[model samples]
Target: MSTRTLPPPPPPAEVRCWPDREALLADRAKAMAELHRLSIGVPRLLLLWLLACGLAVGWGLVGAALKTFEESRPDALSALFGVIFACTAAGFLIPTGIVMGLGVRRDKTVRERLTQWSSLDRDPTNDARFRSPGVSLCWFVPSFLLCTLGLWLSFATPATAERGQETYADVTMLMGLGLILWLTGLLGIAKAVSHFRWAVRLVTAVPVSAGDGGHR
Candidate 1:
C-alpha cells in the first residue's frame, strides 16, 4: 500500500476568491473517479457471491427430482434421497471454496484500491463517507442476518435425509436467505450510485474562481 497523500488545497483566502464552473467540475470529476475506482472491488465480491448462489440452486434442483415423499416406491426414494443430499452439499461447497480461493487473487487489488482512496483530496467527492449512515446500517443488518440463516440451513443438509424421508423446509430456508442477500446487495448498489451521482453534481456545479492575475 502506498502511503502517498494528495496535495493539499491552497490557503483558505486564496481558494475563497473563486469563479469558473468548468474548473470546478474538472476538479470534481477527478476526485469522484478515484473514489469510484475504490468501490470497484465491491462488484467483484458480489459476482463471486452470486456465482456461489447459482451453484447452490443447481444442486437444489437435483435434490427436488430425487425426493421420495408421498410416493409408493419408498425404498428407491430413500436411496435417492441420500444421493440428493450428497449432491446439495457438494454444490454449495464448490462455489464457496472457489470464492475463498479468490481471496488470494483479489486481496492485493482491493488493498491497492483502498490505498488510493485514502490519498484522495478532501472534497464533496468524499460524501460517500458521510452519506447514508442509516442506509449503510440498514443494508448490512439484513445482509448479515440472511447470510447467517443461509449457512445454518446449509449445515443441516445431512439431517434432511434421515429416516427414509426428506423435508424441504431447510432447503427453502437457505434459498430465502440467498435471495435476501442478493436483493440487499442490488439495492445497496443502486442507492450508492444515485447518491454518488448527486454529490458529484453538487460539487462540480458549485463555483471555484481565481482573483485577477492568478497563476497555478
Candidate 2:
C-alpha cells in the first residue's frame, strides 16, 4: 500500500485582481496627459502677464511725460488710459487667469486620484519625499502673501509726508516682486506636470504579483 498527498488548491481568481498596475496606469495616463498638455500653456501665460506689466508701466510713463496733454484734456486722457487698461486686462490678464485656474484645478484632481491609487503600496515613512506638496505651492503662496501686503500698504493712511512716499515705493516694489514670484510658480507647475507624466509611466511599468486584469 502507498500513501499520497495532494497539493492545496490555488487562490481564487478575484483575490488576484485587486491591484492591477497595467489597468491603473492606463487610466491614470489618460487623465494625466490631458492635465500635462494644459500645463504647457502655463509658461506662455506667465510671459503674457510679464508683458502686461511692462505695457502698464510704459503707459504710466507716457501719461506722466505728457503732463500738458493730460492737464489740458484730463477727461480725454482718463478715457484713453481706461481703454488701454481694459484692453490689457481683457486680452492678456483674463485669458492667462483662466488658463492658470484650469491648470490648477486639473492638476489637483489628477494628483489626488494618483495619490489614492499609490497609497495601496506606498510606505508611510516616505511621505516627506514621495508625498510632498506640489512645486507651484512653493512660489504661489509667498507671491500672494506679498501681493496682499502690497495692496494693504497702498490703502493704508501714512503718518507723515515722507513716510507716504516711502510707503508708495515699497508697495510698488512688493507688488513687482509678487508678480515675479507668480511667474516663477507658474513655470514650476508646468515642469511638475511634465515630470508627473513620466512618473505615471514608471509606476505603471512596475512589476506586480497581481496581473493587470487583462489590460495590456
Candidate 3:
C-alpha cells in the first residue's frame, strides 16, 4: 500500500502593528473618510434623484389612467399611453432601486471588514476626534431639514374637487410626491440618529491600554 502525503498547512495570517496608537488612529480616520466618499459620491446621488423622478412620473401616469377610466367616455388611446408610461417608469425604478440597495450593502460590508482589521480597543481621544461636533453637525442639519420638509408635505391636505380647480389626477400626483419625500427623509433621519448614538457610545466607552496595536 502506498503512503498518502498531504501538503503542509498554510502559515497563520500575520498581524500588522502600528508604531504607536496615534499612527493607528490616523490610518483609521483616513480609511473611514475614503469609505464615506465612495459610498455617497455625486454619481450615486444623481442616480437616486433620477429614480425618484421616474417614480413620480409613474405615479402621475397611474393617476391619469384612473381618471380616464372613471370618465363616461374613456378613450383607448389614453389608456394605452398611460400603460406605456407606467411600465416605463416601473422598468427604470425597480431595477435601479435594487442595484443601489445592493451597492449600499456591499459598501457597508467593506466598511465593517476594514474596521475589524484596523480598530484599536481603547482610544477615547481618537474616538472623540473621529466623531467631532463639526462632522456631527454636517450630518444632523441636512437630516433635520429633510425630515421636517418631508413631514410637512406628506401631511398637507390634498386639493378637493369641491374646494379647488385641481382634478383628482393632480391631487394623486401631489400625494405620490409627498410619499416619496417622506420615505427619503425618514431614511436620512434614521442614519443621523444612528450616527448620534455611535458618537454617544464612543464618548462614554471605558478606556484601557491599547498596547502595541496588532491584529484587532
The Cα local distance difference test for each model comes to: 0.47, 0.43, 0.54
Can you give the TM-score per candidate against the true fold? 0.38, 0.38, 0.64
The C-alpha stretches of model 1 lying farther than 4 A from their native spots are: 1-49, 61-104, 124-135, 155-161, 167-216
> Which lDDT tens digits does candidate 1 get at residues 1-216?
222332223334344322454454455445445544433335534654565466556555544443443242557757677567657756665765565455434444443443333232334554454344454444455455655555555455544546545455445545544554554355444434544554454445433322232213
For each candidate in turn, give its C-alpha RMSD to the true structure in angstroms: 10.5, 14.6, 9.1
Candidate 2: Cα lDDT at 66: 43
The TM-score obtained by model 2 is 0.38
Residue 173 lDDT, candidate 1, scale 0-100: 41
User: Which lDDT tens digits does candidate 3 get at residues 78-181?
Assistant: 67776776676577667756765765565455445434423444456545554545554555566566567666655663633344466666666667667766
> Candidates ranked by lDDT, best first?
3, 1, 2
Predict model 3's lDDT versus the native: 0.54
Candidate 1 lDDT score relative to the true structure: 0.47
- What is the number of backbone collisions in each predicted candidate, taken in the order shown? 3, 0, 0
Q: Please report how far candidate 3 places residue 141 from its true position, in Å.
A: 3.3
